[model samples]
Target chain A: MRRRIPQLVCGLFGLVTFLCYFSSHPIARKIYLTVTLDYWQIIFAFTLIVGALSFVRVNLRAVERGEDRPYKIVSLIGVVLMPILALIWGIRGGSPFMWVFENIQVPMQATVFSLLAFFVASASYRGFRARSLQAAILLGAALLILISRSSIGDLIWDRIPEAAEWVRSNPAMSARRAILIGIGLGSLTTSVRVLVGIERTWLGGEK
Target chain B: MDVGTLVAGLLTLAILTFLYRDNPIYKMAESLLIGVAIGYVLVVTWTNSLMALLFTPLFSRGELWLIVPFALGFLMFGRLHRRTAILSRIPIGVLIGSGAGVAIPAMLEARTLRQLSATVGPVFADGTVDISMVVVLLGVLSTLIYFYFSREQVGWWGRTARLGTWFLMIFFGTTFGYTVMSRMSTFIGRMEFLLSDFLRIIS
Candidate 1:
């Protein structure tokens, strides 16, 4: 009874939401707008809280087991501290919360992401070898794109930039479009599967 | 130097130190990053979503209909308890159902139909046959065929799929190059921040 009810609710809601998109009746539109805009956002917010709780639980377990105790403690402190700061001081633009965010969080994220530059360089050096026809074509195309986007290509040859642009607009765009179509079909099929009772993986193992 | 900038500079350096080897400082910074990110999200969600959308409407406006979603949202917390964990499935089901329903038609319109329409365009522009249009037409068709796994890739089918692969390679190559350029630009920005903003090495 427990499992059956949720599955029924899922199928009903899925059908309603899908039908609501096509329906222009005042009642349908109102329900659709309310659910999509308000309810979805509220649900997503709760999911974030759930995520935070899960993080705390996992880290607490790690600390209890005495695995990398110092770092785990730092992480736990950070998770607890920031919310208290936000709630107490309020997250106004000039508040302590925002100050920490702008300075500490933003810089750290930027630095971490920027490290991808070095990783990409190392990865490309290892992977971008011209061993076969496909590899040679890929390497050539990559070189053309890199050169065309920089000032060096214009200095070396006038036509290189034009050739690169042609490659992008023609073959690259066509392949991208084909991939997008495949993704669209795949998403549609999966959505249908979820709407039916066939996709029960979200129920999370025979509970 | 100011405290915030000084702290940011040190943290940036600490994170960058990971390139050399994983160490205590890098681990601490990574954890702090995760914590601060979640905290920020919690604050934003509370203010923008929960308080404004859920609580305000339910209490101040006296909208009783909102109780349905409010109850559903609360049920999500049931996962924390072993006995009530099955109750969490209700909310999860609703989320998946609504999300999928919303995405289906949108993807059909934006990705499939639009893409198909775009692919089938005028091959002949003015008095001349456009070479670029021909390339796009052939590329899209062949790539789609290559993706079709129902048939075995032997003889002529293999040759066509091979042609499709060449087009895909060009697409992938250009994407990788662009990504490299973007990451390199970000790396340069961080360097500028450290050099000019933090150390005052450049104006």
Candidate 2:
């Protein structure tokens, strides 16, 4: 009964929203905006609670089970420290909480990302081989993009820039547009399914 | 060198250690990223949604509108109890109804009409060289033709379909290449952030 009612309401809402497409009423637009705002709110509300639980659940179990859990304690400590600090001093500067975020969080994010350069280089080397006709075209496009994007290409050559411009404007952009068209059709079907309650995966799995 | 730059450089070195093999530096860096993301999400949710829709309406004077969302928020939390999972349906229904109401016109405008119009334009502009416009027209024609599942393709139309398929493959191949380049750029940008902003090893 619980599942049945939500599905039915969803179906009706979907029908009205779909019909709203045929008109330009301000009332309809307001309804649309309100619904979207609430949806975004609900998603965040759920995730925030879930993240909190992850810290508590993992650490509590680690202590009880006597596992190799040194890091769990540090994680739990971080979770508690910032919120408490924020509640007392607020999250602004001259507060330890904000200091931790700047000194710790941002740098860690940077550290993680620095690893990606090596990954990108390796991925490019293996994928951009020119064995087939299509591969040859791709390799041509890639070299153009890489050269145009970098300072080294401009230092030694001017024709490289011209060729890169030609590849990007003609072949690359045209190809991107076509892919976007296909992606558009797929998104339409997805939205329609969600409206009709046929796609319950987004709502967390089927009844 | 300043402390900020020295630490940023060391962080970069620490992260790059993963390239040789995974180690303690990578683990610490990974944990820090996860912690920051979780904290940001929490703060945003509290300020943006809970504060706007829930707290203000309920606590503020002369605002009876809070009752509806407060009840709905409570309804969502009812899922915590096994016997009261049925109560969650009300909030869930409201969510779906509102979602479908919002997505209709924006999707049509942004995804459908604008895109179709882009495809149905002239290849040449002012009788000048427009290689992009020409490639675009050809790509649109070939893809649209390839998906001709409704009609028979027994004659010259079959030949066109075959050509269309080849064009479709090339188009997809190029798209894949661009996607790779875009992802790599993002990765590079992230690396730059670590080196310059976090570690301060590189200017």
**Predicted model with the maximum lDDT:** 1
Clashes of each: 0, 3
Residue range with the least summed lDDT across 10 consecutive positions in model 1 chain B: B35-44
Could you give the DockQ of candidate 1? 0.77
Best by TM-score: 1
Question: What does candidate 2's lDDT look like per residue over B27-115, in tens digits?
Answer: 66555556555665566567667777767765875467556656666676556555776666666766665555455556556665676
Scored against the true structure, residue B74 in model 2 reaches a CA lDDT of 69
Sorted into a CAPRI-style docking class, model 1 comes out as medium
- Considering only chain B, report the TM-score of each candidate against the true chain B: 0.96, 0.68
- Give model 2 RMSD, 1 decimal: 4.1
Predicted structure with the largest DockQ when compared to the true one: 1
Summing lDDT over every window of 10 consecutive residues in candidate 1 chain A, give the lowest-scoring window.
Answer: A198-207
For model 1, what is the error of residue B143's alpha carbon versus the real structure, in angstroms, after optimal superposition? 0.9
Instruction: For model 1, name the residue pairs that clash.
Output: none
Native contacts conserved, per model? 0.74, 0.29
* Model 2, position B161: C-alpha lDDT score: 62
